[model samples]
Each structure stands twice: as structure tokens, then as C-alpha cells.
Target: MKTFKSNVELVFNNLNSEKPSRNTIGILAIKERFETALPRSIPLNGYSLESHQKNEYSRWLKINTVATKFKNYKAVYISLKHPDRAPGDITAAEMRFVANIADHYSGGLVRTSHTQNLLLPLVHNSNLVSLWRELSSTNLSAANIDTMQDIICCPGFEFCSLANTTSIPIAHEIQNLFTDPDELQALGNIQIKISGCMNACGHHHIGHIGILGVDKKGEEWFQITLGGRADEKLQLGKRLGPAVDRASITSTVEVIIRHYLSERIDQQEHFLTTLDRIGIDSFKEAVYG
Candidate 1:
């Protein structure tokens, strides 16, 4: 497979070989040509690895689910969960099902969120239960929207050319660790964002628990950040000490969580608030120690 650099070179070469069209090719035309000529595996962004076929289906599904109305529609929101790494990948069959629900219940309207989840806006109160049941059957419903298990992760070395390590698997492991609903509820609302590199495509800088992947002498290492939040009161997370190995990433997170649990004033107080009150040194010591 050719790299993005090579693909650019190919575009220039092809442009040079062809007769000048008004002395320059249109930007859209150039983009189209480059896309057609390049291999599908070439990573352009986090969504580069996503299947186009699935994306098209998702578009159709979202377009059809707009302005749906039922009683108490104002109070209901339908959230569609996309797995880590592979965001917005609803199958054609699944899309049809969701679209049918939207058409029947919602005024055939759906909204795609920046968090990579789909929202069925204004779902009627009467249809909420049926909608959720239908969505649950297909396993497309989001369990924890603003909770800890609702993780945000970037496409790491598996797809991005700029990535230093694999992030998706780590995200999956972290999610698995919080499988028990009670345990998750105890932890309260926590945002964990993982990026394969310092570019912060996963919005790690604004996560309550931010993990940035780095390369240390060809080995994968992760740097942890604490106290960041992307909500109403936004703040950048503070970096803990040095980076840790991939194997210890999950354990390190556990230590941080444990430290918070022990140190927190109450369950109502969020992890960020606790970190702010106690400071980063305490969490750093817990992780490194």
C-alpha cells in the first residue's frame, strides 16, 4: 500500500501528464481523482478506515428519521451507539430497521452527533419504550451516554498514519473493566478519551481522564492527564508524570479511579472536582507508586 505522501506525488504526476484544463484542475476534481487513484486503506482521518457502504446506509437512516412526533416527544431522545474505533457503522439492514422506526415514530429525523453517536430527536413519549426495545434488540442503543463507559477513542496505529500505538483495543479493555452497572454508577460521570498520538483527535485534552499515546524509542507508551472536562465548564486536563507502557495503561487508570474513590468528599462530587481540590501530584503519586 502507498503512503499519503506517495498518493500526493501520484496526483501531481497525473495532473502534469494531462492537458491543462484552464491551466489548473478544480479542487473538487483533484480530490475526486486522488480518492479514486489511492487505495482505500490509506488513512486520511479517524474515519478513513470506515466502510463507505455502511456510511451511505447511515446517511439514509438519519435523513429519514427527522422531526418525528409522539406525546412527550420533547422529553425523549434516541441515542445510537457506535463501537470504539469503528464509529457510525450501521449495516444496511440495520439502517432500514432504524429508518422504519424513525418514519413510524419520529417525524423521520435523525441527528449525527460529534461524539459519533446517532440521535433520534423528539421521539414521542408513547413510542419511547417501543423505540428503545427495538433499538436494544439490534444492540444499537447507547447504554451510558454521559457516563464513564461512554468512552471516546481515536483510530490509532490500526488506521491513522500519525498514530504511535493502538487505542481501540485499550478502549475496549477499559470498557470491559467497568462491566458491572453498579460499579459504573458508583464511579459517576467520567469522560475517558484516548488518542493514539499527541494530535488529540480523540479530544483527549478535554477528557476527565485523558490518555495520549506516544512512541518511546520505538515502544508504545501512554501519558495520562487528569481533571479535563469538555462540558459547560471546559478545562484542559493536567498531565501526570512520565508515560507508562501499554500493558499498564488499564491498571494505571484503575489506580487513578481507586485513588479518587478513596479521596473523594462524596459520590455526588465528580472526579474532576476531586482532582481540582486535591491536585495532580496526589494522582501522579498513586499511579507511579
Candidate 2:
């Protein structure tokens, strides 16, 4: 029987091979190594591991394999906001720290999300509480997951030549505005995505409230879109009105949110659903008027 150490060695050897046999073979070899290194006793189907059970992990494969089962060795997610700029900037030391965390807690595996956050998907459940404390010390934790704070932003004028405005600062401003956790919770699951240009690398087209930066006569102007979604019920948001100056971006968002709050039938009604029911005309009036 191949020991876990030997299995890992074999996997690495195959990966490092100068002339790999075939892609499928390489994949199978790696999968075999993972399976051998972490064997599951119970069938993944209908056998739910307490640690693996979370609303966040629902969309991911629900298999209780050795790799997926975290009760004995749990996993956790950590989000780094504005991962591309400023405070979001990760230094080499921080990268090493993250690597160390994965090695010490999550068996040397790290995952990145489309939202640009790093995920430690296999940390031991026993170490979760302490792990959070450890991660918090290094400013690493999924603090903004499933909340409006988990903003998706693109590289704007700061780095991208195609960008018309600086998205990171705007994103920071929006995130800072809702510092009160309780108030943020009351706001519900709102998604605010920003794109530096019409390229939509930030996926602003699919955000519930999308902001696209446009250049008007060499000045930065932003166009707002309402009711867009990237979820199961995917739909493109409609344009609110004419572009607003960069200075009015935050205030414009505030106005839209205020309108949604005042007119929503109930607290449970989501912004998109409310907009769908009432139509975008009223939101347009609120923004323009």
C-alpha cells in the first residue's frame, strides 16, 4: 500500500515530469494521490459532515470525500477586499504568511474566488475558532462574505490604460460608508460591482447595482444600472439615467438605496424584486428628480 507521503511524492514526480504522458492521465494521477492521501469512510451522498455544512458551500460539490470532508479536518474561507489595490495590496511577506497558514492548517491547499478573495478550503474544524483569531491578527478572514461589503471591483485608471476612472478609491468609499454591521445587515444582500470601463472586467453588468465608469470630454462620469443579477435568476440591469459625475457616485447610490428602502413592500423584499415589481421608472424619477 502506498503511504500518504509516497502518494504525494508520486503526484509531484508525475507533475514535474519533463514529458507528461497525457492530460487525463496526469489529472487522474493527481486525483488518485488526493484520494489516497485522504480516504473517506462514509459515502459522500446523504452523509453530511457537520463542518462541511454551510450556506456558503452549498453551490460547491456536496461530496463527503476525504478532500471535501472537514469535520475531522475542516475548511474555512477568508476574503481580502480590494485585492488589487491599496490596503488590499498583498506583500511578499503576507503571501508567505498565507502559504504558511495553508501548510499549518489547511494541508497546503489554497483557492481563489472570482471575487478575488483567497480561500482556505480545508482547515481543521477544531482549529477554526483559533484559526480565525490567528487570521484576524494578519487581517485575513471572510468578514465580508455574503454581505454588501463583498464588493467586486475592477482595476480602473490606476493600472488599466482602458479605464476612465479610479475604481479602487470609489470602492473604498462605498465600503467605508456602511461600516455599521447592524445597518449593513438591515440592507440585506446587496451586490455593488464597479467597472473602470465598459469592458466590464469587474462584472458590473451583472451586479445588482452596477457602476460603469465612462469618460465624457476627458472627465470621469459614471453610469448606474439597476436590478442586474449574476445568480440563478440571471438578468442584465437597466440603465438608471444619464451618467453622473464622479463626485455624485456615492450620493447617487445613497439615493437609490433610500428609494428602495422607502418603497419596498416589506423588509424581506429584495432590491431587485422590488424594482421588478414596481418598474424602473420610479427609480429613474428618484435619481433624476
Candidate 3:
């Protein structure tokens, strides 16, 4: 007594034509059938399952840096985040340095992270110390991956025509407040994303702390948000309150950070975890008061 569409809905494990939370309705509808009808072919190229052995140099080199080991090689994260430099900016000389490193240590293979950092994906474990030393020599060995200073920012009014304010100075000001490496490590993976406009080129929507610039009666104002995440479990941040003046934005951020430090259960507890436990209410009180 039912139509063809009614039976199709039953195939997707739903009585109604409602979509899945994680995937599109079209994907859910066609995935199983599409895979079942796909042609299988052998890959022309072959690879080894053999893994590389652990080496001594990688141990020390990986202590502060994210030299993640794998079956074939170790992947090293090269931080571009420096206090004086713009969040994602790298000089021509630094680019050449990284290129040389890639050729020498990573088999000429390198990768860029979504967060605007570089990664040497095919680094040999034995070459890690040499790599680290060379990086440190040129001040390219910034180890602040996933820390507070590892900011994701958009080129605001400086470069973009659609911006509400300048973002580079704001980022630098915030970075200056947290210079102690020990303190940075303790903060533990709180991302700060800043957008010049609503286009969200900086991915501000999903930062642990999101800052957006807005034009207010010919003046620049910033709006802050909390609890965003850009990961496997992606989430958008909630607005903190009304936009604050440019001068007060950095101080407001500091208050929020101090509040998290005060409320965290332990040093190892991540900022996101602390936010989850204590809730954004604590941050609200700290920033507003």
C-alpha cells in the first residue's frame, strides 16, 4: 500500500525521511548501494608494512616538539607561531630553511596543517636531532603547537578590504601576555581564532576562544565567544557578551585564561575539559566582573 519512497526511507533505518546527524541525507541514502556496485581493482603501486625502529635522537627532539612516530617514519610539527611574528606568517628565508630541512630530513616531503603550521611527515628518526638543532639555530624551532600562542588568525584590515579591524597587532598583544614556556604548556590546547569579518577566513567559529571584529558606528569593536572546537567532534563557540572595545579585548582574554587556571582540577586537565567541567558561567563572571 506504500509508495517506492516510503520503502526507501525504511532502508535508511528511519520511519521518516529525516537526515542523519553526522552525514548528509543523500550520502546515507546512496552509500551502501554505491559501495556494493563499485568496481574493485588492484593498486599498481605496492608498499611495505615494515616499520622503522625507534632511535635515540628522536627521544630528546620529540620532548617539546610533536615528533610523532609512526610505522614508516616520525612526523615533526614545525611551529610558525612566534611572539613578534604574525600568527601564520613565515619569512622567505624561513621558507627556504624549511625547504632545505624537508630535502635533507623528510625526503623532500612536507605538509601544512589547517592551523597554519608546517609538518615534516617523513622524517627519519636518526635525523631528528640535526633537524631540531638546525631549526633552533634559525629560530624556526618554535615548539608551541596547540598551546595558547598557537593562534589561527585572518589577515584583517591590513590586507583584506572587508575587515572590520586589524588582527595582527591584537594577536601579538595577546601573545606577549603569555611568554613563559612553562605557563604555556600548562594552559594546554586552548585555540584562539580571530576573524576580520563574518566570512570566517580564520575559522573563528570553532576556536576554543573565538574573536570576531565588527564595525560599530564607524569604530571597531570585538565580539568574543567560548567553547568552540575544530576536531573530530566539531563544535561552534557561544557568544560571551556584547562587543568590547579594542583596548579591552586582550585584557578580557586574560581574565578568561586566569579563570580557567583557577578552576581546573589539575595542571594536566586541558582547557576544554576544564571549560566542560566548570562551564562557561565561570568565565562569564570572571570577564564581566
Candidate 4:
């Protein structure tokens, strides 16, 4: 149970192995120590305790455990029970499970995706209950992706080194604006990615509707991109000509969708396919009109 001043030091020590027998054991020693030191509780809502700021890396053994547990969950809960409408904040009890496991197993290494979701990195092949207990504690243990609202967005002004306007608020606006769960489900596999800058930190490069903010001489503007992905079939989005002012972003996005709906060959045409067939130029003309 040796505590290093920095988690990175802990990781390096485990990997390098100062002790002979512990060489194979690696960071498992740290994890075992951490587990003993922490108290256990059932999570009220699924929230991740792992913080992803390069604090530490997980040992192979712990990663295996976490990964294994993930596959066994019946369902992963995306949101937690909160007093307000904000959906994903889990309770403190759940927070402890995430923190203890994340800290001990991975040296508290956590990674947040562009979508504002946290990843536990590795889970192992073990009893489903421990996995369920870990996830259930945080309210993150859910098993449905078919109808889930997988929205991708950037921070905009929040914590970003560069940003002119707020992008998070807009994302929340769209999420709240879309009232019908069935409508979202029917849309089926739509990816909405927003960015505060042209650097595309929010992974606008891979979203169906990629929103990028541009500096028009001095005023803030936005560029629209269509048909992009990073799947096995990776492709970059084509930008429509010219950028829109800050106030026009929401309407412009909706207008682009309207164009897609009006010109789509069929209900089966997704936003990207529709963009491909019509092309970005056509969409630009239609949207700007």
C-alpha cells in the first residue's frame, strides 16, 4: 500500500516493478490497498468517480476486471435521479464506488469523451453482481443503445482555451427542445456534434451535423458541415460556403434539417445520406435561402 506523491509515479513504479515477485503483480497491490481503505455503498444514480486528467493509468489486471463487468450489465443508465431536470448527475454513494474503483484500479485515471460522458476504461470478466453493483451504484448501468439519445457537443466557452460563444447551452437547448422520446427513437442513429472553434475539439469531424464556429474578420460566425464519420468507413465533412452569425446558428441548423426532410429520397435517408446525394452545395443554397 505504498502511496506515491503523484499517481503517474505509482503507474511507472508498477510497470517497472521495483519488487521482484510484485513485478507480475504490478499495480494490483495499489488497488487492493485502495479497496481496503474505502467504504462501500450502493449508488443512488450512475455517476463515474474517475477523473480523466492524466492523473494515472490503470494496471492490466484492473482494466480487465472493469471491462468484463461492463459487458454483463443488463442496461447502462445514462442519467441519474436528480432534483432538477438535469438528467445525468448521480448520488454520492454511487460517486464513492466510482472513485474508489477508479482510484485504486487505475490510479484514478478517467477519460471523458467529446460527448461529456465518462469512460471507466477497463472492466474485467468477473461476477456480474460486482459489475452491476459498481454501475448500479452510479446509475450508469443500463443496456439500451437503440433508442438512446447519443448527442455529441463541445464545451463552447466552458473550460476551453478558445471559444467565442457557449455551445453547451445550445446542446442542452436542443435536448430539452426535443420533447418526444419516440421522435428521437424514430430518428434512429443521428449524431449531432458541436464545436466552439474550428479546431473541432468536440469531434464535429465525425458527426452527422457538424457545427464549427468561425471568426468572420472579427465577428463570430459558424460553418456547417455534412457527411463526416470516423467509423470503419471514415470520411471528412464538406463545409458549406460562408458562415452564419451567432444568432442564426440554431435556425440554420434546423433549416438544414428541413432541407434534408423535404428532399430526402425516402424515410430511410439519414442526414448524412441525404447530404451525400444532394451535396453540401445544394444544402448551402437551400439553407441560406
Candidate 5:
């Protein structure tokens, strides 16, 4: 929305003169402003890893789908995060490899996301396991989509000329903190978007937890935001307090996460829900204190 002025308008289809809503936001403002499809921030309601249990295929089923919606189905996300590469960094061979997977499994259809992951919107559910195995062979099957490890970061000073500070390294540092899959899943659905500069390429502005890179006296600093969303109920995240030095940013994020874990009613209550229920002040105290 920053780069593009409102080119479209969205509203509920059933709304009428008798029963009307003037709120031109949230689901009504999806895309140009219609609620046809949901953004990544809004996943299937009541969806969680526990429901799928230990069955990898079952989990993938939730991420993907059987022949239904479109030509075949939809695969929510195929993580690009790997130990050997930065997030979304796909090599030539990997590109060809994913292309082949799409050709074979998705009717030659795929979609990339703002979060820097790929979605095969036409994969058959029956082929979920097969596709996952193929992607796993190349280390693309992290199954950590929308989890803490599924970080969305822009190419910072390392790549982008407009960047004030490096973003990939900080993303890596945060990723390293939660190397355990179980621990990440325990945290539940959350988003951590980082942008290298004010261009807002990485969408840190609306992340469940946002990290924005800045430069101060030639030193790198980061400001954080809480409770932002780009989903059906769109909201601009509030500034948590102030910027922190680069070295401490990752640890500060951990502190916020720990605070959410401690205060949540249960694992079922997501980070945002907990933050919403109690208030952002609670988190500000936990981090600033």
C-alpha cells in the first residue's frame, strides 16, 4: 500500500442497503478491497500443528490440498529457508528443480509470497508426501511456514543499496535461537518480518513482531513493532518502545516471545491473541524493563 495508491476497493459481497458496513478495511480491503482470497497472515481457523500430530503427510495436507479448488489443489507454502542459503535464496539448479516439481505436481502453477516462500497452488493432496520428499532432498522442506523460523527478511545492506543496516544476519541469528522444530511449533502461528530500510520491502510494518533496520552515527540500529497484521483484519503494528543496538535485537525478540509464552492462557492462544487480550503495554514492560 505504500508504493501503490489504492487502485482497488474491497467489500463484502452480501452487504446491502438494509444491513451495511462502511468499514473499508480488513477482509473488505483485501487485494483492491475484496475478500476473495486470504493473505498469509490469515490461515485456516483453529489450524495448528498438534491437530496433525506426528504425521508429516497430514501436516502437509493442511498446507496443501487434494484436487478441489482450482485445477488440482493448493499448497500453502514451500519454505525457502535452508542451512546453506539465506531465506528465499534459490540457486539456478534449485530453480530448475522447483520448476520440475511444479510441472509434475502442480500443473505448472506456483506462487511466491511476500514472506519469501513459494506456494504450489495446484498440488494434489495425494502427491503431498511425494512432493515434500523431493523438496526435502534439496533441504527446502522445513515445514516451518508461519512459525518463528519462517522469517521474512529483505536483502539488507548485503544486497540492497538502500538498506541502512544488514537484515539477513539478524534473521539468521533469530532463526538460530529456535533451532528446535518442536520449540518453534510450540510458539504457534506468528510472523517476524524484517526490513533493511524504510522502503518497507520486507513488510516489517505489519508483522506480528516487526524489525526495522536503521543507521545512527554510522552504527546499525533496529526498531521493533508489535501487533501488526496484513490479514482479513488489517492493522498497522504499534512501535514497541524504541530502537535497540544490533547486537541486542535478537535477544530482545526472544524476550518478547518468552513474555508471550509466559502470559498466554495456553498453547492454543496465539502470540497475537495473548498480546491482544492483555495489551501491548505488558510486552513493552517485559522488553523495556
Candidate 6:
């Protein structure tokens, strides 16, 4: 068995190994040259900790160390957390610290954003201590399931020129509305996605609750769709009604969720399952009503 110092090296070694013979020097050099260059800490980006092998993981301390290295660069940072597995473990303080460190190191500021992640852009190396202290006092340094915002959303029409509506604004509004910790915890593994157009860039096709925008007579109309999927069970969302106006979108979705709550047998019943058992016709009636 052999191990490569960096993930890149490991990839090259694997490629070379496919030639019916092992590149022994390549393997040895991988051990020699790149090992030290391997990030001492995990990079905050997804790549640094993304699972390369089964049950294998990067060291948290090392990941933390690597994060400091980028304290002051002009970059955007994003992260994902599995909140269903834990609750409120990551704190605003930890987020604040990451932002502070990013600002200090880069001479920029940290911004805790709607999408669940930390930002430390425009930070510089010289201000790492102050950034660290600021973050420490704010309580923003947890990395477990507890202290995470496990939100998933889409670009919608803002980036895509074809968008019929704006997914970002709706996503932001929904995120703000659902600020209650108890509400989030009760939602329990729910995934909400929105698309500005029927193209489904927001992956609304797969969201437990999906929103799609459509054009009607030069006016923005949104379709409330249901029961679309992409995983092992692939399905497309069915339109619940003719497109409604922008102002009504959130209210319509709320009505649908309220319907689900009324019919759900227990807290464990997820959005999809509730939709499944109740049938879309029920949602259609409620939406149209």
C-alpha cells in the first residue's frame, strides 16, 4: 500500500498505476517533494475536506491551520453543513471570527451570509491575532454539526439571463423568515429550492418544496410545483396551478406548507412524504383556493 503526500500527487500516481506497471520513482518522489507542501491545515473550501476515500477524513486542526493561511485574500468562501445531524452547534461568534480573520488578514471584512458558510476575504497575514481574538470573543469557531446553517439554494435569474423571476430575493426572504431555531429544527431535513425559470437552475425540480417562475403575457408568473426529484427516484415537479404573481409566491408556498402541517401524521413526516401520501390534487385545491 502507498500514500501520496498531496491529493494531486495521489491522482497522478493513480493515473500512472493504470499503465500495467507502477511508477516507482513517481511514487517515491510523491513521498519526498509534495508531502511538506501538503496543506498543514485544511483549506476552508470544499476541496480540502471533501472525502477522497471511504471513512477517511482530514484533520480538523490542520484544516483550521490552512484557513488562517488565507486570512487576507480577495476570495469568496462558501460552506455546507448537515444540520439534520445536529442543531445550532455553530454559533454567530464563530462565523464572526472567521469573518474577522478574513478581514484582518486581507484588510477586508467578514460577512455571514444567507448561504450557510463563512467569508474572510480581503484579510491579511499581519492581523491574524486580532482577527482571532475578535472571533474568539464573538464565539464563532465551532466546526461540528451543531453550529452550521445547512441551507441549499440556487442562482435563479440573477445570474442566468433567462430567469423569469428572482430566486435570490425569495431565498433571502425565506431564510430571514425562518430564522427561528425551533422552526428550523422542526423543519427537520427539509430542502427548499427555487428557480427563476423553468430550466430549474435552482434545482427546484428536486427540492421538497419547489418554486418555478414562468412568463405570462410579459408579466412574471410563478408556478407552484410538487413531487419532482433527481436522486435514485427521478421525477419532475408537477405544476400545481397557473403561474401566480411574484407577490403571491411566498404566501402560496406558506399555504402549501401549512397544508402539509395539517395533514402530517407526525414531526417525522418529511415534505416529500407528506406530498406523496396526500397527493398533489390536494395541494392544487389549496393553492387555487
Error of 5 at 89 (Å): 1.1
Kindly list the per-residue Cα lDDT of model 4 for residues 42-118, writing each as its tens digit: 33345333554112112212221222233432221223311122323446775676676666333354554444444
Score residue 240 of candidate 5 by CA lDDT: 94
Local distance difference test, each candidate: 0.71, 0.73, 0.78, 0.56, 0.78, 0.56
TM-score of 1: 0.71
| Model 6, runs deviating above 4 Å | 1-160
Residue 255's lDDT within candidate 4 is: 75
- Any idea what lDDT model 3 has? 0.78
Q: By lDDT, rank the candidates, best first.
A: 5, 3, 2, 1, 4, 6
* Pick by lDDT: 5 or 6, better one: 5
TM-score of 2: 0.74
lDDT measured at residue 77 in model 6 versus the true structure, 0 to 100: 39
Better-scoring candidate (TM-score), 1 or 2: 2
Prediction RMSDs, each to the true structure: 14.9, 11.2, 9.1, 12.0, 9.7, 12.1
lDDT of 3 by residue, 16-58 (tens): 4475533355567787676522111223234222223122223
For each candidate in turn, the TM-score is: 0.71, 0.74, 0.77, 0.56, 0.78, 0.53
Count clashing residue pairs per candidate: 10, 4, 0, 29, 3, 28
- lDDT score of residue 105 within candidate 2: 70
Candidate number that wins on TM-score, 2 or 5: 5
Which regions in candidate 5 have their CA more than 4 angstroms from the true location? 1-54, 63-72
